[model samples]
Target: MTIRIGWIGCGRHATWMLMPQLARSGFEIVAVCDRDEAAAHAAARQFGATEVYGDYAEMIASARIDAVGMAVGPEVHYRATLAAIARGLPVFMEKPPGATAAQAEELMRASEAAKVPVTVGFMKRYSTGNRMAKRILDGDAFGPVLGIHGSYMTAPTYFAGEVDYTGFYLHHCVHYMDLIPWFAGAEFADVQLRKSVPGPGRMLLHMNFACENGVIGNVIMGTVQSRGTPMEFVQVMGDQNRVEVENVINLAWHRNPPFKAEDPQATLDPGCDTLVWTPNFTAAANEDHKGYHALLLDVAAALEGRASPAPVIRDGWLAMRRLERMIALIEG
Candidate 1:
């Protein structure tokens, strides 16, 4: 069944990254909305939506749609989601589901009370290398996870004025709040932060945390790097084994390989040797290693009332709550 969707937020990300993936199959965007009328009409023309509106509420109320999808500001996400849930519609929205954890909690409770599903975009879980690492961790050969470390950095493009870190906290740092917990397979039980502000807009943070399952790790995030370079890496450690994902595309799995320094007949052992993987960019296939396509596939399934592994509002709430805690620590 083709799910008719009322799409909102026709920004660069929506037009370039998300809508193209959503348009692939099993969904028809019947209505488009953005506060910018020009962007709304432009997205409508590009994505084959018949109606365009500057007001999301008007679009949702009048459009003949089965679901809603949006990549908008946090406050709009909260309000628009509530409107959709009130009409018993399924939804998929970008991360930082609301401006605050309390608002996210409200949206979560409302979705539950109305018996609706509201999926959140935490596509880092679906990244190709990260997914591969998760598979290895779940395998019998890999022992219990001991620790995790991640570094995700970007430029201060999120900052517009007076060195405030609100945009950086919401738009950039929030991803790891969900990602680290997901990798640890447990909620965070304790958090401590160390911060450095080398300049007006540049801020660097090292957050140390312990999970409920006894996994401890540090995550490094900042608005102090160039976006042109690789800005992300994740490392998960186990007993004599480790998995590393570099820049979301390259992966290496290290096993307990025997030393071969004195032996001339050393061979690459499948059981103990390290395994690595990198994407074949020369291939003609349109692969989305950054994970929007894969994330939307699950989202579309959920929108059609089928079972999917898409992250939902509760995940958003948890991530937001953790983000708030981190921000409070930073402020203090």
Candidate 2:
């Protein structure tokens, strides 16, 4: 069954990232909506959407879409989601579901009451490297976890026109921030921002978090580094082994076998093998690249009961809360 989708915002985000992926996802986008009539018409034509609406309410109420894909700004997410969920339409909302955790909580509660599932878009959770790392780490193949350290730094070219790197992180970096506790299958028990400062292309922040799983973690993030390629790394150290997700392309596992120095020249010991995986580039499918389309595919399956919806409202709320707290420390 095809899930007919109604897109609520057709700005540059929709044009560049969302529309291309949506067109490739195989789901039907029946309608496009935006306050700007020209943007709506362009998006509708580009994505094969048959209908265009300048009013979001009219689009949601009459487009007959199975789900709403919200690509709008954060300020309107709360009320817009409430209105959609009230009408029994499942929604796939962009991350940082709301500007504040309070707003997310309210939307969560409303969705709960309406029995409508909400999927938050944190596409990094769908990245090939991220998935492989989480799979191996969750299996505990390396024994109990010791700690986690992660950093996301690079250019803020995507949202650069709207805000700089630091501002972008505060608003949208949840794409990766939410994955911290997610991989542990735990929630954040406590968090403290050790440092938050500004610099040229250096929206710098350092944070420490205690997870419910009894693991301590630290994250260092910045966008003020360089206009060069973006850099991201997440590493988890286990009892005697470790796994590292390097950027969006590689998953490396450094292993330690139980051999106790059996040979002096064990330079080729298989026990200490460092395994690496990189998804091959293929044009057959958009989801093959571990892109945002995977998230949409998952959302479609989940809405149809074929699988579970993840990075849901709770995760979005937690991510937003953590970011807000970190920002509070710096702004206050």
Candidate 3:
């Protein structure tokens, strides 16, 4: 009962992160499609896909694809996904699902009308750190969350040409925007964005979000740092403690002081240490940090009537709404 998957867009992300794992996961890569015919053929040959097409429409029409993986750019996502949904194929789309809110809404409507399943590629929501954070929040172990602060900083070299392809926030920082609310167990009420061009080929963006649970979040992203530096940090503060996820892999927790103190100097006493903290770090054994394998597994399980998709269509739509609001704020 192997699930046959048709892959649309055989670029670096697909070749490096996806195809290699499909074979090992018991899913068949039945067909491959890419704008570049050569790339499509190469992927199909390497992955043992039965068919290859330069046009996704051809692949969809001819291949026995039960599900589709869409790794195309933001601009193409809406049309590609809509086409698949119309054809009655379940789809797993890459992040920032579409370039605009209107496009995402269209996909949602189509998905509903077609009665097919759709999932967004906000992989962080499936990460080990995030899973643990969700558990703690759900169990109320962190008490009522107070707020969150997150940062995503990357070197300019990483954006050598991506700025011309996708907006900085959409290409890179959308992950933070999408995950903040999920980690805080809330949805954004409003967003504020501030941007600056400090130098050539460089951009800095600051986003402030007000969440539905009375939690305020601030996210800072910049493409002006040196290479090899830590690029991401997420901190959630609760009533009794706080947790920090560093570089998207490490997790650290600090418990709130058990007793109220009148002054900061009181904690400086040699025997008066108040905060209790524990730290743990584990490398994700899987290759894709977003748990690509787990996602596909979930999809298969859903297809088998075992489990439902996480970060389903509605989750993707909510993230897109926040992204649209943030983009408008930045542009205005």
Measured by lDDT, the strongest candidate is 1
The segments of candidate 3 whose C-alpha lies over 4 angstroms from its true place after superposition are 24-26, 157-165, 256-290, 303-306
Model 3 is weakest, by summed lDDT over 10 consecutive residues, at 270-279
Ranking by lDDT: 1, 2, 3
Q: What lDDT score belongs to each candidate, Candidate 1 first?
A: 0.92, 0.76, 0.75
Better of 1 and 2 by lDDT: 1
Q: Compared to the true structure, candidate 3 yields what TM-score?
A: 0.85
lDDT of candidate 1?
0.92
Pick by TM-score: which candidate is best?
Answer: 1
Model 3 over residues 56-110: C-alpha lDDT tens digits?
8877777898888778887777778888888888887777788877788888888
TM-score of each: 0.98, 0.88, 0.85
lDDT accuracy of residue 71 in candidate 1:
94
lDDT of 1 by residue, 1-332 (tens): 78889999999999998888887757888899998989999999999999888898998888999999999999999999999999888999998899999999999999988889999999999999988888889888888889999999999888776777888888888899999998899999999999999988999999999999999999999988999989999999999999999998999999899899988999999888999999999999999999998888899887776899899999999999999999999999
lDDT of 2 by residue, 1-332 (tens): 88889898889876788768765565788998999999999988888899899988888888878888887878767777887888898888887788778998888888778778888888788888887787787684777776889888755454544554444764546665687877766777787876544543446668888888888888887665664655788999887788998876688899875444877666655557788787666646444444587787777776665667556787777788777776676566
- How many clashes in each candidate? 0, 2, 0
